[model samples]
Target: MAYNVLSVIPARKGSKGIPRKNLRQLGEDPLVAHAIKKSKKSNWIDHVALTTDSQEIAQIGRQYGVDTIIDRPTRLATDEIPLAPVIEHAFEEVDHEFHYVLCFQPTAPLVSVDSIDEGIEAGIDSNADSVVFVRDSTHIYWRDGENGYEPVASDRKNRQQMDEIYQEIGIFLSENHIVRQGRRVGDSSEFYEVGMYEGIDIDTYADWILAESQLQRKQVLYRLIGNGNAGTGHVYRGITIADRLFEHDVLFAVEATEDLAIEKLEESNYDYQIFENEPSFLDYVRSTQPDVVANDILDTSAEYIKSLKEYTSRVVNFEDLGAGTDHADAVINALYEHSNPPENHYFGFKYFCLRNEFRYADPRTAIPSVERIMISFGGTDENNLTAKTLRALSDLDHELHLDVVLGLGYTDQGSLDSVTATYPPNISVEINQNVQSMAEHMEQADLLITSNGRTLYEAGSLNVPVISIAQNHREQKHPYAHISRGVLFLGQAEYVTEENVRTAVEEYVTEREKRETMREALEGHDITNGVERIKQIMFNQNNAD
Candidate 1:
């Protein structure tokens, strides 16, 4: 059977702490609207009514589709009047009878609808006379006496050893018959404990400011540690994920020597800070205390991960395959794979993080002949693979256009400039730096010669056939750069000769059937929705805690 429940929201114009507090805007809506909306959304609430002496408050309640409005008299609306008489007046004003009454205050706008419904269900299930919402309080007790100050309880005991104390948070539910007998709570009453953020009451100006700030977007910190040795894959990956998080206040944190990473952060116009060591970084983390810390520092140590856990609530690691994986809350390694990965670890091509531009671009169609070839080796090509690939392409007899994409950290610009100037009439060299339209370059090219990093996934998304060269030992073990996936993996850059690169380019240029087969294989993998999948994991981890 369904129980008839009535929810009442009382708003008065005589608030001494803050004038017109109920009608003032908190976030997007007034303070009183939150209470009315929560009551209307409750499944156990049969009807909702507003009791107020001010016409302005009554009009606002009508806009929220309240069932009825009880116009309180001047005598009963005074400061000395108790809540029991006001609830009794509202009960007599309504036309229909109710079995239970819920007294919700407009000041406590953080109370959830589920809590209200749960309180009603608890009162009906146990056949109790009253139900109240409470929150745990941890404070030292003290009292004033005729002599001086005295301790109310034992002051020697610690907080954990002390008994748990709960304080009522302005919400009261009682049987209608008991409320009519001039009692807010009867002898039999139960309590429902709520979280800290949910039981906040907006009585003072400071309290209102605190509630409004929480309703805004959450703060997120991206701790990206990328350099010449570690490569710039983590830097680019961190920026891509931060751009997609539009609902958060994203900031970048890097080391003092990571000039390339700092340049990219400034180019993207993001807020950032530079630290000297791990201890300084931990100090910054403790000072800010963000809701989540996105660590893109490659492999992390167990001690470093544990130190981060002390400052932040959640730690999300990207491309991590070290002892820290055992302690991290969530780990995402898209390039490498493990035989027995952890439960929170996400590996393989399914979680590849691509930029927004490449994910939304249309797939390119294969042409009959190879005309243009593109070369890109991440943001900081520490191995100087661009010069090596350009020299090999210059030795080719086939007349083709070369688009050499230089990174911001490329230091050997004079050597590349000399090679471009000494090119033959049949061969042309076009150097592009910090290009935003990388997908456009990939789409216009017949093939791409790059490293086994984020560019490999971007090229695959456009269905551009690639010839991947490992810049270091780490990229050699990357599973995504394989012949089955339309990529011709040419071992490492240090071992690959000029003749080997030229021979491989000639084979793909002459055989049209081989190029089409590679393009077809590249289209088989779905990498467009990897960002969404990773976001769901982070959000699930946040809600679980």
Candidate 2:
């Protein structure tokens, strides 16, 4: 059953904080109009009206077409008087038989219909004296002591370990009796935490500036897809882009089946949602109405891109080869090459988005001989090339150190461990996962053996000599791994024999000048500034629209 709710937006115009604040513009609407329009959209909120002392405020209220406007006395309108008496007078003036009353401050323009509904729903379900809308605070509480300010807690603790403290945003839904009694809340209350940004109240100029800044940034939804089979490169790529877009409101949407993506996202500490299928995902897109949809899933279908365009302002697909390139605003592929591509399609190394650590990585332009060998087949190593390549090298007579880097999603850790134990004491093996800094390892290595993917671009940036083996046919098509670009392009893993890998490893190990030449050739390709370039492309397309 729906609750009968009355929303009263209070806006007293003559202000000490900021003059004409209620009438002042916030984004496109006046401050008071935000609550009024948002309240009207609530499915559970029955009626929404304005109660203000200023005639200008009332005129703005009527301009927005509120259901009712209650005039407040000059005495109750003063800054000295609290909101309780003003709300108390307005409740008496309205004369409506409502199940509950909601007081939304005009200063809080960030409030949404969803937040209001959540508060009301909590009030009804819990049947508390009031429902207090609050936000989670991590800051340590302090109070003015006899001599100086003192900590509110008995002991200091980390933010994660400490119990969450709910600080009210001065927005609440209370029982009818409490409103009549000139009280905003009672003894019993349910604490409902609003979104971090939505609870922002514009009290002072600093808060007003912050609210305005938040309004200016776009709401971006990153549609990331990954799994044990697909590999976590796409997920990491999406996270890199999301991390770069710290200015915007970035939210990730991944499939429910992509547990690897979920685990990685959790470790990255970002906000995300899980959907079962395409229909539910599109429903989320409609509800979110994201300004831009950035898809990091390698290829996107024309039908999928078309569906996303309906709900978003701009549709951007990364590493896309599907027919969707023609329909999408921008299709940026950092690896593949196309002879006759769609007008919207952009293919090449310039669009590659590198991880943050690579930005500071120095190129090992000169290496005397191959001492440290780095082997990585991406996160999943879906092809099981790491073990095959490791086994292929076990017969090597050369004295060298092998550094095996596997993905977190790698299923056969046991196989890699067993192979590591078999290596001679002179030829050591070090296996690493969830590497804090990929470039650090790349910087120290004389030669790197990796799959033909985004990792190739990372190696290219640091002039790390690479032996590329294609993970699949799709990866074989990537032109960046070719001999011309400083990498020895071995055919797909299945076609390449264990002898073929060992032969190549022996050649690089034995030939000192060959590895040096490849390392120097890598310096010609400029791939470090890709993340910035990609950001420009996404924003340029958005600006064009």
For model 1, how many clashes? 0
Report backbone clashes per prediction.
0, 0
Off by over 4 Å in 1: 1-217, 226-232, 541-545
TM-score of each: 0.63, 0.77
The lDDT of model 2 is 0.84
List clashing residue pairs in candidate 1.
Answer: none
lDDT of 2 by residue, 28-99 (tens): 999888888988888887877788888998998888888889988899888799988877777778757787
RMSD of each: 16.9, 5.1
Give, for candidate 2, the lowest lDDT window spanning 10 residues. 536-545
Candidate 1 deviation (Cα RMSD)? 16.9
How well does candidate 1 score on lDDT at residue 42?
96
